[model samples]
Target: MNVFDIFWLFFMITALQPILRQRFLEAARQRMIAKIEKSRGSRVILLVHRQETMSLLGFPIVRYIDVNDSEQVIRAIHLTDKDVPIDLILHTPGGLVLAALQIARAVKRHPAKVTAFIPHYAMSGGTLIALAADEIVMDEHAVLGPVDPQLGQFPAASLVRVVREKPLDKVDDQTLIMADMAEKALRQMKANLSELLAGKYEPQRVEELAETLSQGRWTHDYPITFDEAQRLGLPVSKDMPTEIYQLMSLFPQPVRQQPSVEFLPTPRKGHEGGQGTGLFF
Candidate 1:
């Protein structure tokens, strides 16, 4: 080939490499999902969020649980037969409350069992969705966070409490209006969450659990580990499927100029007391 032709061919290959790599990864994810569904006899859906780079610009964009995600999940549930169970793999930091509620309600309404799998964490609105599942499977270290409603950057419960503690004349009109909205939002969240837990727990326990979750008792980012979740009466287990972890590895974080963390990808075995414990690190 001529020198110019060879140079152009190399440029084209370099340009298409990223696109081809992304396409291959997507195909691999689909195949893995199909394998899981076939082995478990359930419809599999994944709501995974990650900070990924744009194909050309390389600018990072963080994903969340949004309306589009809810729409797609609801549609998947609708397509499944009533008798078919669902396996929802969630790995997110949460998002819009309205979108989360839509997905949660849809999951609650499904005839067959709905299981939520968390290999890392599902916080805030993600936790709201997990509440609707018949069972929650998490890795031993994975966590779920609180679902207390936030008004702008502040928690709704805090806003209401602040207004109540302040003198009536000292509070501004705008603050009063915010407090009113906050109270309503808190009430609505409790009611909605209570409805989700209704059939699963006792009447009084339902209200108590709902209030605890919606009352801003803890910071929004506070992690509720498997042990704590169990103590709180949630239907949680540490029996995470290996395929779920494999699926998460496919959704890599955005590439950076310099990686923040690095480790050997393979497991290592350790011997203790002259016995091979098969310890991995």
Candidate 2:
């Protein structure tokens, strides 16, 4: 081959290398996920949320894209038999509101009773997903954070920006506009939290708790421990031992079987909280 043609061929190979590697890795991961789902005998699904990695890096990240893909997994499980019960294992730091809601809905819709096992942490959206389960099992150290929704940044920070930029005391038309926007943002966040909590708690109690927990920035909000989660009426149990991690390690990582696109959801616009905006599966 000519020198230029050889160089072009080399460039093409280099460009495709990462794509090929990613495809292979994804296929293997999906096969593992599917096998784990199937082997539980109870039509169980395993979802891990690693979004805290992005939170630490000061970037938004979608953590539960795989879990949201539960639609197809759920369908596949149902195809095997409609009567199989579902056991969902979750370990997440949480992600987008809508995405969590989607997974929660799928768990709720399954004909089997949904049981959630939390080995470590289920924060934010993760906690939301756990709420959908009939029973939530956690170890002594496991945690579930409050469902207080913040609009990307913390609500207090948004309020501070408005007040500092345009003193609320001597508000101009622009200041008034900024103040109104901030107020609306905070109000909407409060309302969303209230609504989400209402689904899990009595309306009066949820309203009371929402007022107390929705005050901080996203970074500063504290995570509730298993004890606190139980106090919040989350149907949490602490004595159960979790063997999922050990069991996962024993399973042979499955061979690459299909293209990832066949399994993953289509990518869409990014949301404020690093959550993927589109529904998957």
Best by TM-score: 1
Error of 2 at 116 (Å): 1.5
Q: State the lDDT of candidate 2 residue by residue for 1-281, as single tens digits.
A: 99999999998998776567657756766665566566665656666644332212335444454444556545644564547767777776666666666676666666666778887777777776777776888878877775555554644445546677865677667655655666765565567556555555788887776665554434434768888866766678874532465433332222235643344444554575575656432
Superposition error at 42 for model 2 (Å): 1.8
> In terms of TM-score, how similar is model 2 to the real structure?
0.56
Give the whole-model CA lDDT for all candidates, comma-separated. Answer: 0.91, 0.62
Off by over 4 Å in 1: 1-7, 272-281
TM-score of 1: 0.94
**Candidate 2 lDDT (Cα, whole model)?**
0.62
lDDT of 1: 0.91
What shift in Å separates residue 122 of candidate 1 from its native position after superposition?
A: 0.6
Please list the residue runs of candidate 2 whose C-alpha ends up more than 4 Å from where it truly belongs after superposition. Answer: 1-41, 50-83, 156-166, 169-201, 209-221, 239-242, 248-281
- lDDT per residue for candidate 1 within 1-281, as digits (tens), equals 99999999999998898899899889989988998999999999999999888887788888998999999999999999999999999999999999999999999999999999989999999999999999999888999999999999989988999899989899999989999999999999999899888898999999989988888899888999999999999999888878888877887787677989986676555564454434231
